[model samples]
Target: MKTSIIIADDHPLILKGLNDFLLEKKYNVLASAVNGKEAFELIETHNPEIAILDIQMPFLTGLDIAKKCKELNWKTKIILITFEKDENIYNEAKNLGVYGYVLKEFALAEIEHCIDSVIKAMPYFSPELLSYLEVEETPKKLELLTPTELDILKLIAQNKTAKEIGELMFISNRTVEKHKSHIIKKLDLAPIQNSLLIWVKENQKHLE
Candidate 1:
């Protein structure tokens, strides 16, 4: 069976181009939407195998959709396409369980490679995106977890179950669990109240 897909982008041309490209690739273009609401409707209805979402949309952002999708346990893999290559977005996508992320500026060839790599059960980042010099925070957040801990937390926020995150990060589920515990403690977050995911969103800008 062909891999099913739904693409959501506010731009008409992008939606059409993505649809045409995926159709040419022999992937089933289940649906396309210009905004988050339409995308949500089609996604819930069709249950496509993959979803290509633009980070900036009419009403709801790609980040919002990703968080909701994680909650639903939707089987559709998501590719977040955006012009923003900042650390915050990367951290957010990693946390939200998005299957892949591609920049709008990347060549079609790079995007294709990213898609193929993601389908093969690997995380994909464009050379340009990864090569962008990281602007380190002058001083680390004392209340924040370590980089790895944050990474695990980001995946948690993204709604990835322990095992799924483990597979992506090449770590054990138990390790992810331990990181979760440490993250909670470091952030002094009360259990069963504000979720770690909330902390991630609240403090995302500082991660870079």
Candidate 2:
């Protein structure tokens, strides 16, 4: 059976290039898409053996598509094709157990090998792509924030106390203290929550 493929990219030229490349290699071009929502529709119809996905597209991003693919338990192999080289994005892709990554610049050069490698259940990362993934462990201290802090800051304008806030947020007094410490460090404010709340409300429009 012929290997069926799909390409998802916003650019018409890029999409055409991928279609032409796959067609020249005698692969069945099942579908092509300009965005994530359209890609999802195509996947439902074609269920291609492989999908070449661009990270940044209109409506929804490729990461959203990847997440949806996982949720649906689809076994289709995905070859993420993008210009982005962010470590966080690459780590997310890896965690999703994607098959391959082909940089747009190198796709033509490495296309055939990448397809074959993925079919054999081996992961393939483009030489250009490998340098972007420098995933480091997030420090426990940095990530460690008490529930009180979260609740207080997230809904700081509610004007609740450590006791009242904890009850509302479903935490305890000790947790509240930890939250206060974390909040102090985070906002560099006085020990009181009201002033901090007012300050945050005044200056945190972007956050809201």
Candidate 3:
């Protein structure tokens, strides 16, 4: 039997596009909704195997609907589409048991694959989103460095030597080296030639 699906989005273009694509793929598109409330009603009435929802909408958000479905113990699997790459929202979706998360920029390209994974009872998150989360972790890891270590790291990013940094900060070369070592351990950076320098260079933006 063809899979039953309902797609919802506040944007007419997205709603129509996704509905049309799924129909063309020969899936049974039961309905399309323009808001979370209407989308929830469709799910309650039709109980489709899949619900493709925009993460942000009027009345209630996609995460809100997902929470409702979980509360009702419904079998409808949710695939959230959004432009947000926020860590908190992503974590909430995972906690709500959302089956798929596709960035709006890549929705049309990734929807088919996301649907397939959900049907197989597997969760799918955008690969781009994962990469973004990995990059985001660098800023958090940097928080482990003390003020002195952070100052030295920033200087290193600017291509300053330990001696130069010590002069600027009114510290001894030995003290600067000690701070560098502490930063390396705190950040869990690999022990290798200029690893600290490499890390500082790579994460220069976060220093700003």
Tens digits of per-residue lDDT for model 3, 52-77: 99999999899999999988999999
Clash count for each candidate, listed in order shown: 4, 0, 0
lDDT per residue, candidate 1, 1-107, as tens digits?
Answer: 46777889998987787788778888778789999888888889998877888989987888888888889877777788888878888777767767677887773
Pairs of colliding residues, candidate 3: none
Each prediction's whole-model lDDT (CA): 0.72, 0.71, 0.85
Per-model TM-score versus the true fold: 0.64, 0.62, 0.65
Which ranges in model 3 have alpha carbons more than 4 Å from their true place?
135-208
Task: Please identify which of the two predictions, 1 or 3, would achieve the higher lDDT against the true structure.
Answer: 3
Candidate 3: what lDDT?
Answer: 0.85
Instruction: Sort every candidate by TM-score, greatest first.
Output: 3, 1, 2
Candidate 3 structure, TM-score to reference: 0.65
- Native-to-model Cα distance after best TM-score fit, residue 149 in candidate 1, in Å: 17
The TM-score leader among the candidates is 3
Name the weakest run of 10 consecutive residues (lDDT summed) in model 1: 133-142
Report the lDDT of model 1 for residue 45: 96
Clashing pairs in 2: none
Error of 1 at 153 (Å): 20
